[model samples]
Target: MKTTNLLMSMVIATTLFFVGCKPKDAAIQAAVQAKEATGITVAVTKGDVTLTGEVADEAAKAKAEEVAKAEKGVKTVINSLTVKPAPLPVVISEDPTLSKNVIDAVKDFPMVKATVKDGVVTLTGEIKKPALITLMQHLNALKPKKIENKLTVK
Candidate 1:
């Protein structure tokens, strides 16, 4: 009876020892998150860390992985972060240049009159429906800030 009791006690002691030695997932996640920048998400499961969310660039993504790996109790890091797409630059023509271009564009449509100010093109007068599309295409190619169509379409 004493031998059986001793064996049972040893098993219980071993289990507690192992459990106490392992770090909790929540604690590891908190440690990693504190060191990372904003916009990064940290998830921990059984000492494995997964990083997700959008970062500004590839360098930022790599840096986040390094941080997670460096944290204590993190067995491995899985980086699933995405890089943000760059925005397209807007092109706006200068007033003097846009004015000259607008005049040339509307010359073919005798019924259309165009005026440019502060990179904005204003169209007035009358135009046949068929020629309106062509006139607009020409003006848009010049990259004006805005186009105000006040033309009476026939």
Candidate 2:
């Protein structure tokens, strides 16, 4: 009976020791997350921290990792943050303004006829080889949605 009681006592003591030694993952995660910048997500499991989310730049990504590493009870830091892509510039000229500009651009090349619809300039007719380049450059400067060059170069 005494031997069985001692074995049970040992088992309970071992369990308590391990439980006390283990770090609180939730508390560590909350601490690290509070220190990090917006858009950063912090996850902690078994004292290992994983950072995930989109940051503005490389510096922000590094900063988030640093924050996680600085938190107590964090044994390892896994950085999985991604940098956000830059947005493309939008340039679309109004149809009326583009039409006026197209008319002026083709005026010097009388043989070339220009038509504008929905910010698209369509060129149909005949134009000198040398004048075609100049007319195209002028139309491109107006930032139309598209340009259809059907002019016959003579």
Candidate 3:
């Protein structure tokens, strides 16, 4: 009878230790799968999900939340995502002279395309002649905060 009692106690202790260790590994697996399936990388701690990485907009953010919540072991989801806005295309205004000047500037560069919207000029396309930082400096001189250059030239 004493031997049976000891075996039972040992089993109970082993079960408790295993139970304590299981959740951590389960949470890690859930986080990895959540990231792989949803494209939203997540970190799971004690079943709490932390959604991270850059997303396009709010919809992507909400979708990530839903994905993490769907995971069986997740207790709560904490969203922390950055939204990157799309660059606007270049469009000249009614004034011919000003539009022509802007066009001349782009033509001189041979790779940059500037798009003006609501007085917010977004320089898209590419630039090859000078370094990207130099081009940005010139554009910044033209307009302080209104310049959004989405050019990729190596």
Candidate 4:
């Protein structure tokens, strides 16, 4: 009977050791899998994982944290993932309508010159901060192929 008790105690100790000891690499691997979506980045320090970078939205950020927490050895998760603002879609188009819109949009701003070519928009000259921001929003909606942003913001 005493032998059986000693054997049982040894088994329990072994189990506890395995359960409590978790490796850092294993946690890092789990963090990688968790941050697969978007541009989220992970850092592991002493079983505490910190997630950083910008994601598409809040849900993506939350998912990353949840994944880190679910890992075997992660004692805490510090999710600092920020949601990036949506930008205008860049569609390639050589349509002359883009030029017309750009002209009409920034006609009052004499310091700016815009040229459209092969679906790409090139802006040159100096532009005021307020107008430049507004013009960009309008230009983005036009969905040009690429923007050669040479316009100096003042």
- Comparing 1 with 3 on lDDT, the higher-scoring candidate is 1
Which candidate wins on lDDT?
1
Give the per-residue lDDT digits (tens) of candidate 3, residues 36-74.
434566777777877777888788878777877776667
Give the clashing residue pairs of candidate 2, or none. Answer: none
Clashes of each: 0, 0, 1, 0
RMSD of 3: 9.6
Clashing pairs in 3: 90-115
Over 93-123, each residue of candidate 4 has an lDDT whose tens digit, in order, gives 5568878887887788899899988878899
- Cα lDDT of model 2 by residue, 1-154, tens digit: 9999999999999999998877699889889989999888889989999999999999889888887888879999999999999888989999988899888888898788989999889999998887888888899999999999998989
Once fitted onto the true fold, the runs of candidate 3 whose alpha carbons sit more than 4 angstroms away are 1-11, 14-21, 25-39, 93-95, 99-154
* Inter-residue clash pairs, candidate 1: none
Count of clashes in candidate 3: 1
Candidate 1 lDDT by residue in tens digits, 42-73: 99999999999999999999999999998879
lDDT against the true structure, per candidate, is 0.93, 0.90, 0.67, 0.81
Candidate 4 colliding pairs? none
List the candidate numbers ranked by TM-score, top first: 1, 2, 3, 4
Which segments of model 1 are wrong by more than 4 Å?
93-113, 122-142, 146-154
Query: What's the ranking of the predictions by lDDT, best on top?
Result: 1, 2, 4, 3
TM-score of each: 0.65, 0.52, 0.48, 0.43
